[model samples]
Target: MTLTPNEILALPKVVLHDHLDGGLRPSTLIELAAEIGHELPSTDPDELARIFSDNADAGDLVRYLEAFAHTTAVMQSADNLRRIAREAVVDLAADGVIYAELRYAPEQHVAGGLTLQQVVEAVQDGIEDGVSEALEAGHAIRAAAILDAMRHLDRSLEIAQLALDNRGRCCVAFDIAGPELGFPPAHHREAFQLLRENHMPVTIHAGEADGAASVGEALGLGSARRIGHGVRIHEDIDGFGTDEVSYGVIAQHALDQQIPLECCPTSNVQTGAAPSIADHPMHELRDLGFAVTINTDNRLVSGVTMSSEFGVLVEAGWTKEDLFEATLAAAWGAFLPYDERADLAESVIEGYGIDL
Candidate 1:
């Protein structure tokens, strides 16, 4: 059945792979930049908006990522980080995301002298505040925090420890992000081992800029429970399509492991991972039984939302039922406890008028 963009958005959703820095509101960036005297490419809100547009529309990951330098610059302060997280939750909730797990590299926040613990705790405070506000408005939104260690750096073990320390608190998982190709997950093997020993939930940014080997390494070395943008798994499939398609061992293993692949269509386009929304591997991944779920990797950098991602998928020929399944994939892959994840699945079924 057909569904309009607003209708698609109204169908309750889950966002498993979103970044706190990548989702800031533009006006928030302007205000925080002003308060901190940080020079910007464009101070005017309109110009700033256009700048964001150019970055995303440029279809270049490096250019799109440069925008985060400004955002992270302003967010170095605890108050700014808190406000960004709080506002991000409200925005995600308004977009009908029943649950969200926001990730960011804490080392980036130390520029303003806040300790790693302080940065994580501050974002946690913001998420709690946002969830409370949403609950007050009768929405009952749930939010979790994931600590991301920049892979190019040597702090993975420390960040993993931090997330584990806050595991049952506001924090839910640990991640490794940043440039991927040369800096393999093997670099962070010790950190992943530590997290695995603690039974901590883990997700890794894999297969976006890199290929299947990177994804294999994330699972093999990092022991990632979920793969962030495992789109490159498609590389293993040759001539896949028509009245039939095929899945290689790597792709099939991801399915077998039930490791959710966070497919951010728009962000993939901007990052050169996919040529366009229509070219995304989402359909291929899902059709092959891979746990593929939609996401907004960097909402502000990509200037999109969970709703917008769904809209793009629909525009690319996804059906209402397809969206329902994708939403279920996200809910099922959420880093919540087993009981909580089950509850989310039930809520999603109720929200989407579906079973299972």
Candidate 2:
């Protein structure tokens, strides 16, 4: 049975791969851009939103990422960073996100002279503010930060330290983002080693612009607890949908470990990772016993919410049970303590009125 729109919206979601810089509200972008004298493709919110959505559908990873320039341009100041973070939480809560780990590269936001620590603090402050506002509004949401270091840059070790230093304050984990092709996770080995030594959770952005080799390196070398946009793990599977399917080394490793795949269907389609949502590997991966979870990689850039992402899956022939499984997997895969993950899983089961 397909879920009704209201049913979809009422389901609790846990988003682990959302980017703070990619989820800005169009109106907020307009206002912040004007304040910073940053020129945008369009000043009108509706028009600007259309431009971002359309441009990001370029079916190319690098082109899809270019939309962030405008969003990040306004996010340089502490106030702007806080506002964006606050709005992200408020928006997610309104969309029925019970828990979220919003991520952003601290190094990117240092353009306005804010130090890395200051950037983390600003985002954490904003998340706390947003959580308070959501609770007061009767939403009851919890949100935190994931500090990211651009993969192509040389500051992964420093960013790893930053995340470790702010472990409980707001930052929960560390990630390496940015263009993924030439700059594999190996380049950030030192940073990954540091985070590994400190026991900081990691989720590497692999198998998106690259392939299964990138994913293997993420797991084997980077010590990733989760794989970001890991849809391309399908590449390592021979005859993915057939009964005679065979798993390659990386695929076998991921399956053996039950590693969570942070699959973003809409963003993956937009980035040309999959031909379309119907053809996406998420459902098949789920059927394969992979830890598959649904996510909105970027709200504004991909023009998706948790509800809308599920809605698209429904349109593509997914049942409500599929949605429930994905949500439960997300709760289990959250970068939270075991008790907290259990709590989140319980919340999901309660929201769905079902038991796994």
Candidate 2 C-alpha lDDT tens digits along 90-131:
999999999999999999988899999889889999999999
Highest TM-score against the true fold, candidate: 2
Worst 10 residues of 1 by lDDT: 238-247
In model 1, residue pairs whose N, Cα or C atoms come closer than 3 Å (at least 3 residues apart or on different chains), thus clashing, are: none
**lDDT score for candidate 1 against the true structure:** 0.86
In candidate 2, which residue pairs get closer than 3 Å at backbone N, Cα or C atoms, i.e. clash? none
lDDT of 1 at 192: 89
Q: For each candidate, what TM-score against the reference?
A: 0.96, 0.98
Off by over 4 Å in 2: 60-62
- The 0-to-1 C-alpha lDDT of every candidate, in the order given, reads 0.86, 0.90
Candidate 2: how many backbone clashes? 0
